[model samples]
Target: MSYKAIYTYAWDLQEAGVPAAVDEFRRLGLDTVTVAGSYHAGKFLRPRGTRGKVYFPEDGTVYFHADPARYGTIQPLANSLLAEGDVLGELTRSDMATNVWLVLLHNTRLGMAHPESVVRNAFGDPYFYNLCPSAPDARAYAVALASDVTERYPVSGISLEAPGWTPYAHGFHHEFALLKSNAWLENLLGLCFCEHCLASAERAGIDARRLKAQIASDIEAYLESGIDYPADMAEAFWRADLAGDFELQSFLDFRCGVVTSLVGEIRDAVRADATVSVIPSVARPTAGAWYEGSDLPALAQTAGIIEACFYEASAERVSADLFDLQRRLRGAGKLRGILRPSYPDLASKTEFLGAVQALRNGGVEEVAFYNWGFLPQDNLAWIGDAMRELG
Candidate 1:
């Protein structure tokens, strides 16, 4: 499986326009609702220069049907009409909201507490900063934290965004060292370098030395693709296409084993049957060979659905059908592709239609726009009718 050829399914959604949002979903004739992970208005409330208060409350608050303000409080599953498909706040049971997927921001309280639960390298230290799944403290924190979120919210799925497996994601090699083992401080300095990691790897017969070499190699791979390498690595991991080469299955096994352990624990603790999904950023080596080690086969092993992010305007740069072609390599029927509005301020109806037309023809079953917050209401009329007719 080289590139995951995606099937058109549905588009991303948000708690926009209240009841009108559902009407928009209907008008568009979309079948699925995709809520982004940690997309909230109350968050950071303001961007760099903005002064006015964020008009919409953070989606985390009521989107999950939970009172988002209180961290520990669990709201009653009060809304009888709330169904998973209601990406907007006011979903009714009668709306037939079905097959909705909510995106979750993944991280244990320990991730916040220890800050180092995520892997990082700062100064000259080679640290194990990633949340140590095998560690008792990490496990306890993960179980409690995930349980708290799901129990507090009314989500149908969890999207692991902040878990930071790739080592190239945001805050990669974050400067989060909590321990100061001289040997670890000198080397083996990442977050998971805690006592638990050493003991677990020893028990599992995982050669710590070998793991170190792999980390060095993988970090270099990330850097080769222009992704910043963690500070501690000796060399760069070569940048390759996220949609790998012929030996994809081997990498898939490793990815499945590695990522699955993290996600599986969350599902085991929170929603066991959570509809897990993956959406890799288009920022990395979309054009490179099998370097990023995406391993769609491996992703498929752990995920309920896999979505690849292709900016709506991508069609203009390449053939319109390229994204669909990418999806086709997966060979799995569960793969889906997502599209966002080309522009944040306003959408070009022509581009929307063209992209969708291309995606549909490319064998995709669904497409989604970013958020309702900025999408012009007038354009909503155009989208509703256009989307409904796609399938």
Candidate 2:
């Protein structure tokens, strides 16, 4: 049977009532409800929210009550709502199969508290929103978080998001910059030169100091020369540039190894009964996942499933993305494609159904919608219709 699910926030279900939300999910022909176990702050406009139309969650807080004893230098803060009730526990007790969606290593709140544990660029400026996976404390915290959730709740599985490095251009609140942005510049600035990363590179026989200096110098030259890299040439730029630089390619490969090992550790830490899947990268097309340290084949071997977010506008683009990802995975693991059924990705129900059809035709046995709160009631209907028609 094809597995169908919708990504949902814990707060949304809490307001809508757990039992009622489960009924809605079942009504939509979904087998599972992947709710947020831990999440970052976001100003979300909820179309089906009962509490309020606009909502902002507590920054970098877990929806479930976390075991304090399982943590170290970095820890997860429980959302204030947990004081009133256990939303996650309530959901697990319901009829729907529950999967905890964890946003790991992307908490700005923890990064701000433990500055030394966050990702630092070549210039030593910290990206406070992203915790460096190479840091021992950060790595321990991620594993502990996953283990804690699975241990506490009778969850079927856990989907790990942002378990590796994040890009520099990720939209943070009120983010403003005077300089022009491109894939080349963002990738250059996103290179982590933190002490942990440098030490890892050294152990791998790389000239860490020289590479750091070279990247810093390259950024300076690019800025001074006012080079305009066309957005369309992102893939071509990386191919040509990395092909010429053996050391740079090795450095990126080592970064992927860091992420892969961290994910493997998390997978081992979780209970054997609970499935451990990973959102390999937030990058579109997923082919540019190397910049965020995600190796698809390596991840497929480490985790149970690779939930590739194929967020494209057309069904053709969605099919093309699945084909590329399948070729890269080389049949190492299961693949689940995630789609955004609302505007900017799909304009009408027809387009949404077409995208779902494309994934099914591409040999995907499982598919998921982006989020419950973000979509209109019409979009929910689209999901139900698509599930019935496809099945």
Candidate 3:
């Protein structure tokens, strides 16, 4: 595998274009990059949870957004994706050390055109937001979007931001819900009782109704006790609220299968050696609720890389932990760390460099920084210098 340091995404530069940023990255020591998002790329995360918004993805694994739209479709946003690819390709052509990773935003115009594909919530209410991967239109949209990526620019490959799982099973109005919900900043995600989800469970050999009954009983018990139970119990009660592990795992497996399967299909669409990868949540659900439900065994068969996503500015321990999580995957050593440079978490030059050192020390082969535009130029310059100096 290549031991390259990459920036996760090109942060939106409303004023400065992608070409400028890519040029700067080449000068900065960035040999590889995985563009995080461009223009309302996060549109698909609706019915949002406490984390504000998931960008897009109100639905579960199979569902897609009702509509697909890109952010800032004006001159800058319009040409942003291609511009970045062009610049990234320039770096690659100039020197094999540089590369690009393209991704389809879940909430783009492509997602809007296919709402039925988005996941339906517990109330049979689908978030008018998010893209549903299970819908036929989703495949069509992806094929077209991905084709544009592989065909148009100098993209080395593309990867999607990791999909999150909501373990809390209360109501779509539940506290953890992220997008398309009444609350955008709570820790409450409800149990999904939508017919499609139930049917999916049933198809997985589970009796969905039984699971609902369990959830009801657990909730009643928890309510009668009048205590804040552990997240694990809350989750077990919630999932049992829907069905049994057989069905839950079955649902999880099916959902995870959808993503990995897409990876396979995407592999067919891009360059034969174009790498296909997924960024999954670092940990597993203790209560087996919901989160990035990746099938590592299955993923190992197709994915060329694995990424651990988290906001930048995390503790060094977090950087080490990210490295550890990647290590546990089937490829063991072929793991990369993804860091987002969002607000309230702007990593400093020292902090970013420390993060890189920690991950390298932890045995991570590749480290990616988030959004290029938002980060201070000096930071990238520092990173470039560090990458050249680091072993």
Candidate 4:
């Protein structure tokens, strides 16, 4: 079943501006191409290229796009590369399956416009960069957006990334850089205390307010003083000897529930024939996995495919991570390994081939390259070589 694929930014297709890009994929011996459908709002610094704004489109989507009559406001970027070219059509014609990749809950546009739905820190600060999954508007928007892409395009599958909540430590800009590094403290500092989360915790019979106050106080103290607390504070806070808090554990469980529920909704929103795949972060057991609401077991129940990401790591490390994630998700469904064969990880063909072989041995049926645009032209043929060896 060798299902080899490559991920490409929509801008890459726009820049290439030729039907022959399909030929390039054919030469690489790739069977699938996943294109970025609706992405986050940011300024990406392309290689040797001018920076461009990544945003929600006014076209290509059946919903969530600009509609002056229905929304009373039209999004500025009405024309996009997806709507302008026949790239999707061409890829389909070339006998390659196309998947529309969607990023959820990471939109700065909606988060900034509707601050009410943004994630709130324990210190009462709102991170206007991340949309709250528990927010009704944000949930509805994500579902509608996923449905629109599947309904309007000829995509064979729907790939969901960042479908859950984000950490508070993100989007702090230069402030985050200046702070000291402490995994346990960073994890605690990343917790969210938004209104929706708080209300849900209350309904679940958990004292979210008390936990929030304690967290705020501890975090504030840690910031003010260089004194280090217990090394296992993040995980041990629930222990009887430490904080003896069961309600705090319940609060964490509530966050995971929110994420699981969102994945289920997105699965139902897409077309029945298309597969729903999710990408969750890879973290150590010492670091709580449910913090970002990425419960593999629960989410796997709703999703058809689990595209485990093992990016920016060595071949042996990628092998270890892929195997561990495979064990966790294997009982649920198929596994697709995503990798980066370019800088910071591999410098030669031996490393790339070793990684590909490791992925196959680790029970990965499909392997998707990190991206086509980020890697140089010379590095692409390695994909073909690996696929040939595997075949």
Candidate 5:
């Protein structure tokens, strides 16, 4: 379909209220809105007097009863703006396809509260903000969240973000220093050895403890000597020597399997009415996509759409990124380009149009803006103008 959508948070609906916001979108000639169904903490809509971390507010989920029993407390935000019956239904009546955007794993509250469910590094230090995909409780939590959203809303699509395990240096405060101190070593350091993950490897007949110790020793040696570390982490993976390390290779495959299982579970849980999609995190030109455990071909079997992000400062670079994403997807699924409508690339009307054109040329069937609450009215209006130009 001719889908032109924008990404919005629940707070955006709260700020302008549903009626006014819907009118603004229609006035801008947009056909769909990918609203954040579940989210993490952010400063979105702060200018409109909205504040603090919010969870499960707009989502009408009672949550799995086992959630609170298994983990001390399960609390989601209440008094949500979309709690009203008419808000989302109104979008549907207005012929606006509502796409529910769920942030799957990067939840600060869940990650901080349940350390056992989060990622553990080679040193066994838990990264409290990124969930481990191998954790049954964590995967169940995600599936429950997805099922709740799909069951509650008459959504046209469901977009899953951060569904895989996060990489090292994600929540760590020493990212810059770590980058300077053998960044490739940081890749080796980030491998998870959590109990759940270890058990998974052991089930596959791989010696988990021995592999972890070897990885730790290698990382430490690289950090101390700054020698023998591959200049690029991506190259290290493809090198024949790493392939010889069966345990290391198995661990990599295991990570991908965990992510695939979770994504597949969510896809199966959600009703067939809503299209399921995933946004895999990849820092361009890097094999970080695979490192993030998103096997595109595998995920495509369940996820019908792949929402590729095109957040570059230059329109030309935006085109390049979209092209790169298209190549990676390899017809695995439909592509939807997500753009940032702010300075540099979208500073002028021509630039904004150029970005849209680039996405279109890259074979993106649809396009969506990054956020409604984060930018100014001028930027929002730019989207309207750009749509008119495309027409």
Candidate 6:
């Protein structure tokens, strides 16, 4: 049978009651419920929330109970609601298969607490939201979190999000930028030159100091020039620019090596029964993965599955993305596509069904929706309708 699932949050299930939510999921023709196990803070406007319309999650917390002994310099804080009762534990008890959605290496609370362990750009500006994967404590914390949840709960699998470097344009609280932002500028600013990163690159035979100095100099020159790079040509320009720079390309590859190794460690740590999957990049079109150090082919070997977030508007775009990703993966591992069936992606049931059809036609057997809390009642109906029609 084809696998179908819905991405959701534990808070949403708790609000609707676990049994009721399970029934609703089944009603929507979903076989799995992917709930947030560990996540960063977000101001979510819950359309289906009964208690309130807007909810702000506690920053950098886990929904499941985490064992303190399993952690290191960085530790996870349990969501206060976990004190009332374990939402994840309750979900695991249900007939529906449960998958833990873990946002690793992107914790603002932990990053701020351990500034030395976070990602620092070429100019030494620390991104408090992104914990450098090369840091020993960060790696340890990620592995422990993955293993701890799988060991305690009988989850079918774990979906790893933000397991690699995050880009510069992430939606931070009141993020303000007056200068015209382009891909080249963001990528340069997002490059991590932290102590751990530098040491890792050095060990891998890269001239870490010289590379950092060159990057800093180039960024300074770009800023001084005030070049208004066209948005259409930005990505192409960046790639061509990287092609000419061998040292920079090697550094990016080293970064991917860092992420791939960390994922392999997490895979080894988790229970043997649970499948490991990585959401390679949150970037659209999926090709922008390298900017965040997510190499699809490398991750395909390390991870059991690659959950590509195809957050596009039309079926044509979705098909094009699927084709490109499959070509890149070269059949190394299983590929799954995630689609948003709500506004800005799929406006009607026909569009949602078309996207599903596009994936199915592209040889993707598993399809997952974005979230249960964010979608409206009609969108849920559209999902059920799509599932039935496809089956």
lDDT of each: 0.41, 0.88, 0.48, 0.69, 0.71, 0.89
Better of 4 and 5 by lDDT: 5
Local accuracy of candidate 2 as per-residue lDDT tens digits, 41-65: 8999998777789999999999988
Say which prediction, candidate 3 or candidate 4, comes out ahead on lDDT.
Answer: 4
Off by over 4 Å in 5: 44-94, 172-182, 223-246, 285-287, 344-348
Residue pairs in candidate 4 whose N, alpha carbon or C atoms collide under 3 angstroms: none
| Candidates sorted on TM-score, descending | 6, 2, 4, 5, 3, 1
What TM-score against the true fold does each predicted structure earn?
Answer: 0.57, 0.97, 0.66, 0.86, 0.83, 0.97
**Model 2: residues with Cα > 4 Å off, grouped in runs:** 230-238
TM-score: model 5 vs. ground truth = 0.83
Lowest lDDT 10-mer window, candidate 6? Answer: 170-179
lDDT by residue (tens digit), candidate 4, 1-391 = 2457898766677667536667788788888888776665444434433344342233222211432332212122233553576565555556788887777777666566778887887887887767788877778777766776677566788788877766544553345456555655666666778898788888988899898998889778878897655656634543542245577668778888898888898888788888888876544431235668888877778786777777644678777776667667658867777877777666578888898999888767688986787666667778888889988
Per-residue alpha-carbon lDDT of model 1 for 1-391, expressed as tens digits?
A: 1121111111122222334445556556554444432331222222211234244332322234544333322221222224545433333232523333332223322244454343333222322324444444444543444455456544444444432232323322224544322211222223233344444445555554345455556544543555433443322212232134322234323433544465556556765544555553323333321222234544545555556555535456324335533654466525555555536322577766666666667666645554444344555455564565563
In the order shown, the candidates' Cα RMSDs to the true structure are: 9.5, 1.5, 8.1, 4.2, 4.5, 1.3
Give the winner by lDDT: 3 or 6.
Answer: 6
Reference-based lDDT, residue 330, model 3: 39
lDDT of 5 by residue, 35-152 (tens): 8666665323433335543322422222111123222233433323434444555555556788888777776667777788888888888887677788887888788777776776
Which parts of model 1 have CA positions greater than 4 angstroms off?
1-17, 36-110, 122-169, 172-256, 264-275, 280-294, 316-329, 344-347, 378-382, 388-391
Backbone clashes in model 6, listed as residue pairs: none
